[model samples]
Target: MELIEKHEEILERRAELLEQMESRREQLKIQRTKQVEKSEAARHRNITLLQDLQKIEDRLRGRQLPRPHLLALETRYWASVEQSVPAWEHFLLGKGPHPTDGPGQPPRRTKQTPSTAKGSGLPPRPKPRTAR
Candidate 1:
């Protein structure tokens, strides 16, 4: 009788241990499922953020002009300005109209005073003395 009771107790303890192991396995599975769901949600957010960043980069690129084209335009504009500046200086100095001006335009002329005009080399005559 004692042997039979001891055997039954041992069997019962084995069954309880198996049940506890199964419960622990189910809890681990549930925790793993939740972790996987969280990871998937984070992945989705990361993908969206990367897409947004790409779109912003594209827009910035679209708004910017190419460097070579901009540089060409700047060079042309400065060349035009440089060409006009010398011509304007010549005109202001009263040298003449710009060479680029057409033939129909009259030459600019400034009036000359006697001091500025070319003169023959001659001595000035003395004024006659007044009668006493």
Candidate 2:
């Protein structure tokens, strides 16, 4: 009888220990899941920050120098303007041959006296009546 009671007690203790171990395992699993979720969140944040940094770097590089195509366009525009400046000056100042005139002909001058200025489409204003 004594031996049977001792054996039964031992079996019960073993069962209790097993139950505690199972509960501990469940707790450990929950903790591990939480840790994994935190790590994944941190990883996503890091990736986003890296992408933002890359965008900023790209913008900085763009600001440092204009694109080659835009630079070329600007250079071409200035060259065109410089080339035409002499012709424009000659035409405006009437100091040399005009671009539209024959090679050796001088620029033509137009008279611009106010009395002869009737090019405006609007009818001339009536002269203000004197305050009699």
Candidate 2 worst ten-residue window by lDDT: 113-122
Model 2 steric clash pairs: none
| Poorly placed runs, candidate 2 (over 4 Å) | 64-132
Taking all chains together, each candidate's TM-score versus the true structure is 0.49, 0.49
Clashes of each: 0, 0
- TM-score between candidate 2 and the true structure: 0.49
As for candidate 1, its clashing pairs are none
lDDT of 2 by residue, 33-70 (tens): 99999999999999999999999999988785778999
Clashes of 2: 0
